[model samples]
Target: MRSLFKRCMSALACLLLALPAAAQPLPYHVDPDAREILPNLQPVPAIRFLTTADFPPFNFRDPGGELIGFNIDLARRICIEVNVACTIQAWPWDQAANALADNQGDALIAGLSMTPENGELYDFSSVYLALPGRFLTRAQAVEGFRAETLDGQKVSVRAGSAHEQFLIRYLPNIERMEFDDELEALEAVKSGSVAAFFGDAMRASFWLNDNLACCGFAGEPYFRPDLFGDGLSIAMPAGNDAVRHAIDWALVRLKQNGALDELYLRWFPVGFY
Candidate 1:
């Protein structure tokens, strides 16, 4: 009876110890050398990714109600390569940023650009694409255009965007009308509520070709080094080294395998950047 009691106590202690280890979150990293030799090494589990579904050509909800776009497709591919299930949640762009900050999602796969202000709040993956900004105006608005054509003209831009920051710093005298999304900004331009709308060249081209019957690029493409960073990248909340590493590795693999190039061609056949 004494021996059996001692054996039972020992088994309970071992089970208690193992329980804690099993309940703990998986470590993000493993020793590379050991992992290389151990084929059975497990990866960190998948976490949800949040994005705004309004940005077309990057992430948008299709008529079929599926989240479908370049970024969405790329993120799904990356998750597959990493052997994790990725859940995409659509929220407003600003709400998505807040959700990422609050740890509601593992990362933001929207067409997020790496800017100094944003970098202060989050970690960023290597750039996936480089696109220039363009100015769109009604064809009649360009009739008497000069170097300072946009001066004093009401311009619509997405609030808190790189274009907004650029205009604030460089074109301070211009009347600025900020919108929550590009579609809204385009609407403001189309309705004559604003004289012009400034955004990515690809997006502007998309709008002009698809939506705006009388609007087109008014001037040469603008590339400001200080305002727009090298290109757009995926964003993860600050100090998320594990998630960042996995995403970076997956992106590099996609680029190397010609998947990214193929995606660009398929989405933007006319070419961007």
Candidate 2:
């Protein structure tokens, strides 16, 4: 797994400092177009971020067994913004959540998507990245493609993914062909067996980096928060509002200074937004 900051640290630093530091454009991925500043947000007294390193680009272990990834970078930066010593430890995903709950960890820094049920057990910081829905079609397809125009086209989606369920519920008019995996679905599109592949925007974009000989995104990203959950966030145990709020404050500081976008682009060079 490639560590976003480790791979692009110098480039990201240059990108952030290109302009007068005060007037840089805050990078917002899409829709809710502005980053919500948490005025009342505050940080915990100390910072110890618990995480799992299986999710690459976001969180993963390097070949040296060192913890390194976007989430790891984000966690360290947040601690620096809060002016505290920070320690990150990798645990099993389930244990990370438990560690936070048991007070063994101060925060959980995995790629956790916000959900209603999880909301009851934990509080989360504002989103750092959204896993949106996107369409993959032949590069030569018509311009100005839109959902309304997909009515008669054959689109493939993983049989039971959230994207598939979203297609069934929201864009029922389009002809959806279910496949067992996104790779197979994408292959179908490549073979001209299907007009497009509909799925997770991040995965699809990454897929295109290596296999886009015949395809590209067909439309603007679909960010149905209802279907995709609420994006990746810092999950802190419920009732730990101080820690949650503090992380939120740190996020705002990072975003305002362009550090957030730097990390974002480093990890997601082939971004949908």
Candidate 3:
């Protein structure tokens, strides 16, 4: 399950490759109608967000050793929306959760899994981003690629992954060629060894932009929150309703006013959606 939070650690490469996809629409996870009515605090408490710097595009250090990424930017935006003082700090991934539990930070925005066990320990803000499974196929094969149409066709996936399990559970008819990692599975598609490959959209987007010039995304992205798990949410100390509610309310406002979409486009120029 921890694999859900695993991400490529090449923030600089991703940033260099990111190109504006102004022609495509961005994905929205927050509902515009979702609003919170919380008791107003005369002086709202400051929020300190804890994160790790290894996950590229989400949280990572730039060339100057300054922490910067999508999550950092979003955390600041949430603070701005709620009119609260905010500070972001990066810790080693292994120690981040323990630090949060030790009262080192008010919230964690380091892609914490919203699992039942964690739900008991932390109050999670509404899911801010959900990664989807997508198919990457050779340019020519994309013309008529359809999930239903690929009944017995060969497709590559990482061995024993959630993506592999998803294929086994849903598209059982397809002949799966499992690889030990995403790059191998993608390579099978690039070399025409398989008709397509299925895996995490974010990683695939990075590869599509950086390597694997032979393939492109095919069909709409598949969203199985039950299988993929809730994508990404800010985790706060359990029962911290004030902070949680404020962040949730700010997320809704961010989506409604287009600030969130702007950030999405800026970070994910080749958007997974």
lDDT of 3: 0.83
> Model 1's lDDT to the true fold?
0.68
Model 3, C-alpha of 200: deviation from truth (Å): 1.0
Q: Over the stretch 141-215, how does candidate 1's per-residue lDDT look in tens digits?
A: 755554266788899998998889878887898999998867779878778898888877665555554443577
Task: Give each model's whole-structure lDDT.
Answer: 0.68, 0.74, 0.83
Show where candidate 2 strays beyond 4 Å: 1-45
Q: TM-score per candidate, in order?
A: 0.57, 0.82, 0.92
* lDDT of model number 2: 0.74
lDDT string, candidate 2, 1-273, tens digits: 123324533443333224232222234743344554543433445788999867665666655666777889999999888777889989887677778778888788887657777778888877877777888888888377777777888989989788899888888888999988667798898899988888887767556655546788787777888877777888888887777767887887787787988877666655665
Backbone clash pairs for candidate 2 read 42-245, 42-246, 43-246
Displacement of the residue 67 alpha carbon in candidate 3, Å: 0.4
Error of 2 at 246 (Å): 1.6
Q: Write the per-residue lDDT of candidate 3 for residues 1-273, one digit (tens) a residue.
A: 234224445444455445655556577887656656643644457889999987878887776788878899999999998888999999998999989988899899999999889878889998888899999899887777788788999999999989999999989999999899778788888888898899999878877766535888899989998878779899999987778888888888888888888888777777788
Best candidate according to TM-score = 3
**Residue 195 local lDDT, model 3:** 88
lDDT of 1 at 273: 46
For candidate 1, give the lDDT of residue 45: 78
